[model samples]
Structure formats: C-alpha cells, structure tokens
Target: MNLKNLAAAALFAAGSALASLGVPHAAFAETTKLKVGYLPVGVYSYFWRAQDAGYFADENLEVELVPMAGGGQIIPALQSGALQFGISDALGVLNARKGGLPVTYVSFNFSQSSDNPVHAVLTTNPDIKSPKDLEGKAVATNLSYNTDWTMMREWLRKNDVDIDKVTFREIPFPDMLPALRNDTVAAVGAVEPFVTFGKEQGANVLGHYFTDVKSPVVLSGIVAMLPYVEENPDIVKGFVKAVNRAIEDFKADPAVARETIGAHTKIPATAIEAMNLGDWETEVPPSEMQFWVDAAEKEGILNETDDLNSLVWSPKE
Candidate 1:
C-alpha cells in the first residue's frame, strides 16, 4: 500500500508541474490575432502610433497597418471580411448603415471638443476672405456635397451665400494645394494634417468649422464587419484596450506619440499636431452622432429616418 501509493502521488505531482508549465499538448491555443485597417491621417494618429509601438501586443492582436487609398475601398473591404476593422469617417459609417451595410462602429477615434476645428478652408484666391466669400467661387473637395459640403452649404446659406451661385469639382486632396497655387480652385477644404500642409504652402486658411461645431459633424472611428464582432468579441475588446493605451500615450508623451505617428503615417508629427487636430478618445457621445444624422436630414442628404440603434456603435462596456 505504501510503495504503490507513493509512486502514484509522485507521478501525479510531476503531471501537475507539467500542466502548470503549459504543455502544448494540453494547453489552450493562443487567441487568433486581428488585422485591423486604418488610414494614414492625423485623425488616426493614435492608431498609427499604437501599431508601431506594439500597443496591441498586450491585447493579443497583431495589427496590420493598412494604408488605405481612400475610404471607398475600406468600406467594401470591411463588408467582405478582408479587414477585421477600419478607421473611417462618421459619414461613411452612417451611409453604410443607411444603405444596409453590415459594418458596425466599435469606438470613436475622436469626439470631444468645441475647438476641435476640422476641415479647414484653404482658399487660393487672395480676394476671397472668409468662408462666406467662397459662395460665388468654384470649390474643390475630394468628395463634393458628401462630407463637408453639407456644412459648407449650410454655413453659406446662413451667411446669405448663394448655394447655386457656386460650383464644385471633385479633386484629390494632395492635388488641391498645387491647384490652389495654379489658380484652379478658388477655395478647397483641408482637414487636419492636410490643413497644416496647406498652410505651409502659403494658402490662406479662410475658415474652419470644427472649431465651432463640437458635434459629431466629422469623425473617423474603428469599425468592424458585424460578423467579425459577433464571431470574435475578444478581438474587438482587445482593440479597445490597445487604442485606449495609445490615446493615453498620445496625450501623455506627445513627443513619443508624434515620433510613432510620424513613422507609421508618413506625416510629420509637427504637422499632425499643429493642424485642426481634435480629441482622440473612446467616447461616442450620443449627442455627437445626433449632430451628423440631424444635419444630414436637415440638408436633405438623407430622408427622415430613425435607425439610431443601428446607426451608432459604441464599445460594449
């Protein structure tokens, strides 16, 4: 009884020690890593920095820095599961929901401040002064009458600037600066990172609206295909933790954040922080989303609708 029992106990102790060491044959598999997509813009500075700085490592995510050509592909890629998540504007998310797209917002990248100052108006025409002055002139925007166009139009109408009196042509953002210098577009909308770049080029920053409109009028956030979120809540959860770390890093050691951002985004950190850079956090204040939806409805860009439940997506607490 004594010899046999002692031998069994020793074997059991050895097995327990091996188990504690996490033997591959018996241990649970590592979590599946995530490949999130993002654009190289100041709006996503934290995300870019976080990817480079290994912020997602703790969350078990291996971030893939996707340099998006534009939002057009990002949305479709999300739909097709080509991307686990993406950083894109509120307008694009709204349009996707309105059109029955299957993607859902995981968290807001930026949505907190009155002086946030997005979409700065850089006019080439020295004669055209304020935002009000651009009414009669032709404006160039990457996506006309879609994004800042509604707000621009509203600001124009409120200030008695005739909407029909002006014309709009779609021009890529980078091209606008050269176009401005060459006397092509009288005025162009330049959001952060680009705004600073435009200013450096000697373009007159006539006006900026994000400084006033503290609403969700403009936003770029984390979005994942609904299926991905459903299939892997853990991945989404990790993304939040990673971004949260990055956000704190951005505010705390801005110098380090800039270095990280400059490297990943290919946009200078000085240029990035100097622009109309707004808040970058996890808050998705309902009031902000209302601003975009209400503004769109008021401008007739969207008919009367009520999908607040689905239109908005915030991180699950």
Candidate 2:
C-alpha cells in the first residue's frame, strides 16, 4: 500500500487544536523559512507534530514539509537545494556522503526500542524458521543498497547465513504484499504499519530484524548539507529544538500521534491505531552510529576512504 496519500488540512489542524499536547515554546526574534522533505509515514510523527503544534513557528522557522515518496528523492532534493533539510536513513546519508553529497544527519527521528521495532523480516513460507533457512532465497527490500539492505545482510551473517548467497530484490513497500503473495520474493524486509499489515494479511513474521542484529538500532533522522549547517548553526538548533518539542508532544498524548500520522500517511485508521510507533528522540550516540557506518562500509555502500565525521552533525548545547 502507498504510505503517502494527499490528505486534508483538518488532520494537521487536529494536533495544534488538541489541549493536552503541550511543550515548551521556542522563541526567535527573526523568522527563517525552511522547506523540508519527509516520508509522511508514522515513523515521521515528530515532523508532523512539529508542524501541527507550531513548534517551528515558535523557533522562528516558517517550515514547509514537502511530501516525499521515499529516500530516493529526499537527498537529491537537499543536494540541489530544493530542500533545506530532509528525513533519511543513516545508510542513505552515509552513501550520499560517500558519493560526495555533503550532507550530515542533524536529528534522530526513530530507532528500534525493545518495546517497539521499526522493521521486521516477513515470509509467507512457514518452513523458513530462521535467517539460515533462507540461504539461497530472494529477499525483497525497498532499496537495493540502503540501510535496510545493510541491516538485512548483517542480521543474516550473524545467523551464519552467507551474505553473498542471498539475492535481494528491490520492491517498493506498497508492492511487497503482492510480491510476497505471488512468490516474487521468499521474504520481505518491512517497516512499521506494513509489518502489522503483513501479519494481518497472513505473512509469518520471521522476527524484528533490527532487534535480531542489535538492540536500540538507530533507523533514521533529519539531515542537511554540512556547509548549510556550519553557516547557519542557529537555524539547525532551531529546527532541532522544534523536533525535540514535537517528541515531547507525541509522548504526552497518544491521540496527537494518531491524528498526525493519520493526517499525513492516510493509512487506515485501524492500522494507525494499532501500529507500534517507536521512540522519537533527538539523541543518537556515536557508538550506535558506528554500527551503521561499519555496516555500510562492510556492504560497500560507503567507500573505505570516506570519513565518518563529515557524515554527521551534532548540535552544541
């Protein structure tokens, strides 16, 4: 199913109107307008909350959240300056920097918590009990050389499954169901809502892949060009401030999340209501980041010559 469907203003307005959703206000004397691209999925509830609660405005940021289909277009938009900032996975940012995109991750969007998993490996075949069972099988991933692919490889290797033996098929999240049903791919690496939806459709969940590899896995976050960040550190701070506030708003009330996610993704109310939303935070430790960078390097998604420091941006207190 297509995660993003154009929705009306009322859904967005719902967050701002809710009385229980409250966070400290950020004040800036000068307003800076920013155009940001986001996936418009439940994973990006913080972005919608930031917009819905006027946190961006409080931080003197007139933000425009451009709806993006996936990571494929987000970085390119940032590179060409079409977007001042965009949400993308760690591996995408690492590979982009390896390809000379000059981008750095500025904030954390979501990560794998013990209570909630952002991704899972699903199979229609019940015989495939473990990663090793799918030794020579074709697995579907949304992107051929992305964070999910890297994580899948690592998770497989840990299970003694030969990484070189498995064939990966690139399929969009929406088409994964059909692909699995038609036996196009033996298994699919699916993210939230889809994981739940896949289960609802009778697909056997192998396990939450991230948890199988490592706990507290950092999945994705906000990113922007390094040069832009250095030149306008305050803007970065303002944006991050808004994100932090949005995180609190989400934690404060469950209804705010339901409304914001429903507004942006247009996923069915039942799915949205039942979806396991992971932790939304602004801090991703360097050690946690090293795991993805190492995975990217091992997967050849990043060049050995690439420097890790340039690929990340941490705000100063």
Q: lDDT (CA) for every model shown?
A: 0.69, 0.80
Scored by TM-score, the top model is 2
Query: Model 1, 50-146: lDDT tens per residue?
Result: 6666777666577776778655678888888778888766677767767778766777667535556657778767788766677667887777535
How does candidate 2 score on lDDT? Answer: 0.80
lDDT for each residue of candidate 2 in 147-254, tens digit (9 for 90 to 100) = 888778878888898978899889988889889999898999998889989989899888777778887777788899888899999999989988989887887886
* Clash tally, candidates in order: 2, 1
User: What is residue 34's positional error in candidate 1, in angstroms?
Assistant: 2.8
Q: In model 1, where do residues sit more than 4 Å from their true spots? A: 1-31, 112-118, 215-218, 265-273, 304-306, 314-317
Q: For every model shown, what is its TM-score relative to the native structure? A: 0.83, 0.85
Model 2, position 285: C-alpha lDDT score:
60
